[model samples]
Target chain A: AQTVTQSQPEMSVQEAETVTLSCTYDTSESDYYLFWYKQPPSRQMILVIRQEAYKQQNATENRFSVNFQKAAKSFSLKISDSQLGDAAMYFCAYRSQSAGGTSYGKLTFGQGTILTVHP
Target chain B: DAGVTQSPTHLIKTRGQHVTLRCSPISGHKSVSWYQQVLGQGPQFIFQYYEKEERGRGNFPDRFSARQFPNYSSELNVNALLLGDSALYLCASSLAGPTGELFFGEGSRLTVL
Candidate 1:
C-alpha cells in the first residue's frame, strides 16, 4: 500500500514571496507518479503539477514547481511569487504506473496542507 | 470544454438513510473516479471505473457502491449512512490512457444528521 504524508498542517507566505509545501510518501514500487492538487474556497480540486518517478527532472508549471527526490521518497511543491489567489488547501498524491491494467489511476492522497497567501 | 460535473451540490440525509450521487465526466473522458473528503482532511479514493467497468476500489465498506454508464457518467450509492459518512463526495475524470491527469468537479457535499 502507498501512503502520502504532508507534515505541515498549515502554511503562510507573504504576497510576492515563495512557499514550499512538504510531502513524503511510502511506496515500494519504483515506477509511479506524484501529483499536487489545489482546492480553493470553491472546493474544486485542481491539478497543480505532476512528476514522473522515471524522470529525474522536477516538474514545473509556471510559478508552481516540485522538488522531487525519488530516492528520498520526497515530493515537495514550491509556489513562487505567491498571490492571494493561491490561498487554498494543497494535497499531495501518489499513483503507481498502470501495468497490464492492474492499477490504473487510483490516487492515494496526503492529509493536505492549508496554504494562506497573506497580502 | 466542460470539466467533470457533479449533481446535488448539497444533500442532507438522516442516519440509516440511503443516498445517491451522480457524476458526469468531461467530454471525451472515459474514466470516472470517486473520492470522499472529510472535514479538514484530504480526499480518499473510493472507486474508479473505466470503459463501464470497475477498475479499482478503496477500503470502503460494502455499503458504498458505484457504477459507470455507457456514456461514461457514473453514480455512487451509499446505504445505511452513518455520521461518519458525512463528507464531500468528489468526482474526477480523465482520459483512458496511462499516466493521464484527472479533472475534478466541485464535489457534492453530504451532511448526515
Candidate 2:
C-alpha cells in the first residue's frame, strides 16, 4: 500500500510570490507516478503537475513544478508567481504503473493542504 | 474538449436512503473513476471502470457500486447510505486507468441527514 503525506494542513502565500508545498510518499514499486492536484471552492479537482518515479528530472507546468527526489521519496510542488486563483486545497497523489500499459488510475492521496494566496 | 461532468451537483439524502450519482467522461475517453471526498480531506478512490467493465476498486464497502455505460458515461450507486457517506462525490475520466493524468468533474455534493 502506498501512502502520500502532506505535513502542512494549511499554507498562505503573498500574491506574486512563490510557495512550495511539501509531499512525501511510501511505495516499494520502482515504477510509479506522483501528482499534485488542486481543488478550488468550485469543488473541481484539477491536475497541477506530475512526475514519474523513473525519471530523475522534475516536472514543470506553467507556474507549477515539482521537486521529485525519488531516493528520499519526496515530491514537492512549487508555485511561482502565485495569484489569488491559486488559492485552493492541494493534494498529493501516487499511482503504481501497471504492466498492461494501463495507468491503474487508482490513486492514494494525502490529506491535503489548503493554500491561500494573499493579495 | 469537454472535461468530465457530473450531475445533481447537490443533493440531500436521509440516512439509510440510497443515492445515485452520474458522470459523463470526456469525448474519446473510455475510462471513468469515482472518488469520495469528505470535508477537509482529499478524495478517496471508490471505483474505476473502463470499456463498460470493472477495472479496479478501492477499499470501499460493497455498499458502493458503479458501472460504466457503452457510451462511457458512468454512475455511482451507494446503498443504505450512512452519515459517513455524506461527502462530495467526484467523477474523473482519463485516457486509460490511474496511471494517466485524470480530468475530474466538479463533483456531486451529497449531504446525508
Candidate 3:
C-alpha cells in the first residue's frame, strides 16, 4: 500500500513571497506519479502540478513547481510570488502507473496543508 | 469542455436511510472514480469505474455500492447510512489511461442526521 504524508498542518506566507509545502510518500513501485492539488474555500479541487517518478527533472507550472527527490521519497510543492488567491488547503497525492489489471484510477492523498497568504 | 459533474450538491438524510449520488464524466472520458472526504481529512477512494465496468474498489463496507452506466455516468449508493457516513462525496474523471490527471466535480455534501 502507498501512503502520502504532509507534515505541515498549516503554513503562512506574505504576498509576493515564496513558500514551500513538504510531502513524502512510501511506495514500493518504481513507476508512479505525484501530484499537488489545491482546494479553495469554495470546495473545488484544482490541479496544481505533477511529476513523473522516472523523470529526474522537476515539474514546473508557472508559479507552481515541485522539488521531487525520488531517492529520498520526497515531493515538495513550491509556490512563487504567492498571491492571496493561493490561500487554500493544499494536498499531495500519489498515483500508481502500473499497467493491465492494476489500472485503477485511484489517488492516495495526504493530510492537507492549510496555506494562508497574507496581504 | 465540461468537467466532471455531480448531482444533489447537498443532501440530508437520517440514520438507517439510503442515499444515492450521481456523477457524469467528461464528454470523452470513460473513467469515473468516487471518493469520500471527511472533515479535516484527505479524501479516500471508494470505487473506480471504467467503460461502465467496475475497475477497482476501496476498503469500504458492503453497504456502500456503486455502478456505472453505458454513458459513463456513475452512481454511488450508501445503504443503512450511519452518522459516520456523513461526508463530502467527490467524483473525478480522466482520459482512460494511467496519466493520473483527473478533473473533479464540486462534490455532493451528504449530512446524515
Candidate 4:
C-alpha cells in the first residue's frame, strides 16, 4: 500500500511571486512517478508537472517545477511567477511503474492544498 | 483535440437509488480511468480500463462498478447510492503507454440526498 500526504491545507502567493506546496509519501517501490495536479472551479484535474523517480533531476514545466527528494520520499511543487489561473486545489499524486501486471493506471493522491494567488 | 468528456454534468439522486455516469475518451485513446473527487479533498481512483478490459480497481465497495466499451468509452454504475457518494466524478484518459500523463474531463457532479 502507498500513501501520500500534503501537510499544508491552504497556501497563498502574490502574483508574480513564487510558492511551494509540500508533499510526502510512503512507498516501498523504488521505481515510480510523482505528479502535481491542479483543479480549479471548473472541476477538471489538470496535470501540472511530473517527476520520475529514476532521475535525480527535478521536472520543470514552464512556470511549474518539482523538488523531488527520493531518500526523504518528498516531492514538492513550486509555482514560479504565479498567476490568478494558478489559484486552485493542488494535489500530490503517486503512481507505480512496476511491470508485469502488478499495477496499472492507478494514482494515489494526497488530501490536496488550496492555493490562492493574489495580485 | 477534444479531451475526455463526461455526460450529465449534474444530477441529483437519493439514497438506495442507482446511477450511471458516462465518459467518452479522446479519440484513439484506448484507456479510460474514473476518479471521485469530494469537496476539499483530492481525487480518488475508482477504476481503470485499457483495451476494453479491467486493468485496475480501487478500494471502493462492490456497489461501485464500471466497464469500458469497444470504442474506449466507459460507464460507471453506482448501486445503492449513499450520501457519502456525493462528489465530482472525473474521467481521465491516457495514451498507449504508461498511464502517468492523464488528460481529464470536467467531472459530473453527483449529489446524493
TM-score of each: 0.98, 0.96, 0.98, 0.97
Show model 3 residue runs off by greater than 4 Å: none
Which pairs clash in model 3? none
Error of 3 at A107 (Å): 0.3
Global lDDT of each model?
A: 0.93, 0.90, 0.93, 0.91
Clashes of each: 0, 5, 0, 0
Across B7-105, the per-residue lDDT of candidate 4 in tens digits comes to: 999999999999999999989888889999888888899999999888888989999999999889999999999999999999998875554478899
- In model 1, the runs with Cα more than 4 Å from the true position are none
CAPRI grade, predicted model 2: medium
Best by DockQ: 3
Clashing pairs in 4: none
Tell me how each candidate scores on DockQ against the true complex.
Answer: 0.76, 0.64, 0.77, 0.75
Better of 2 and 3 by DockQ: 3
- What lDDT is obtained when candidate 4 is compared to the true structure? 0.91
For model 4, state the Cα shift of residue A4 in Å.
0.5
Model 3 interface DockQ: 0.77
- What are the clashing pairs of model 1? none
Predicted structure 3, TM vs. truth: 0.98
| Candidate 2: residue B21 lDDT (0-100) | 98
| lDDT tens per residue, model 2, B33-69 | 8999999988898998989988888889999999889
